[model samples]
Target: EGYGLTEASPVTHCNPIYGRRKPCIGIPLPDTEARIVDLETGEKELPVGEIGELAVRGPQVMSGYWNMPEETEMVLKPDGWLLTGDIAKMDEDGYFYIVDRKKEMILSGGYNIYPREIEEVLYAHPKVKEVAAVGVPDEYKGEVPKVFIVLKEGETATEEEIIAYCRENLAKYKVPKYVEFRKELPKTMVGKILRRVLAEEERKKMAEAG
Candidate 1:
């Protein structure tokens, strides 16, 4: 699949008709330049295979948002690069892979954890029908991963079983610290899982508990 945004005239990168890598967004289109930059400052370009925010510049990119200078300036650099707010990396072959959205990243104990990485592992579990991994507030770690899951029909699973599965598949820092079984996960009208909503709920719950 390709990657683009409304700010970029909606099309930037795509897998070539041939030599396309599965699950990769492919290379930049002709005249479109894309780079992975340091997430903290968005200045230093990151090396290949390193995950960072994606920035792009091309003929198709927008000049500015209509009458929204502050918002426009936040994303559009004077040098013509548009910050995509997407975590991504490029391979040696020049194929671009989207890791996840920057806002949804979980900062747990100094490790950068992407919910998609955790969800992918949980999805592989035989009993898991759907899952959403989100960062919840943690006093000691600043934040930690907590997963909400919907089990497959007639399937049974325990929090310990799920945690053990993650412990086996993921690094210690990346494994979710909490598991909550649910009848269904919240979703957008288009059926995309609402991870932000889950995260907000978690924060609210922690606030109430304290």
Candidate 2:
């Protein structure tokens, strides 16, 4: 249950991710519904068991974008539906789970790397304090997953050990191809991880090192 933007007016869909945190965002408050669709084709209205971009077309849907006609046309189709650029999947029980932001999908050797999947595994490790997974350039794969980690105070873990741990938990393709440790992580006033900024900084460092 985040802020309701123009695309999804009045905020109709949500999932209960956290417990005891400001009512319930997960379960729909009633009189609201949602759906999932394949972004590439937009033909398959995937079943609840599949993962796809979340699209909602109801009374709460937005009319159109502010001004940009092309941008508005790209999102709002002739069928009167707004394609929210959020990736999500619905459960058999009818609740929807937001996977990642649309633009955040990292393409690595034909694989889609979602940072949340990798970050979830990293967070489960006892020594890992905070982690952000990003895609870095790779000659063969086009791009590869890289993990930026911050350890808990008074704890220390080598990059190899961390990588090994991830290997044990994730698929070989899902495991981070690169690992970097830092004392503290950069954060904004609201404390959401700024991944794009970190990825850019890492690319800059690589350029300087070269």
Model 1, span 125-164: residue lDDT tens: 9999999999998989989999999999999999999999
lDDT of each: 0.94, 0.77
CA lDDT, candidate 2, residue 130: 96
Model 2 segments more than 4 A misplaced: 1-3, 14-33, 205-210
Among these predictions, the greatest lDDT belongs to 1
lDDT of 2 by residue, 85-173 (tens): 87877776666677887767778888787889999999999998899888887889988899899999889898889889989999889
Best by TM-score: 1
For candidate 1, what's the RMSD? 1.2
Q: What is the lDDT of candidate 2?
A: 0.77
Error of 2 at 121 (Å): 0.5
User: What is candidate 2's CA lDDT for residue 137?
Assistant: 76
What 10-residue stretch in candidate 1 is worst by lDDT? Answer: 16-25
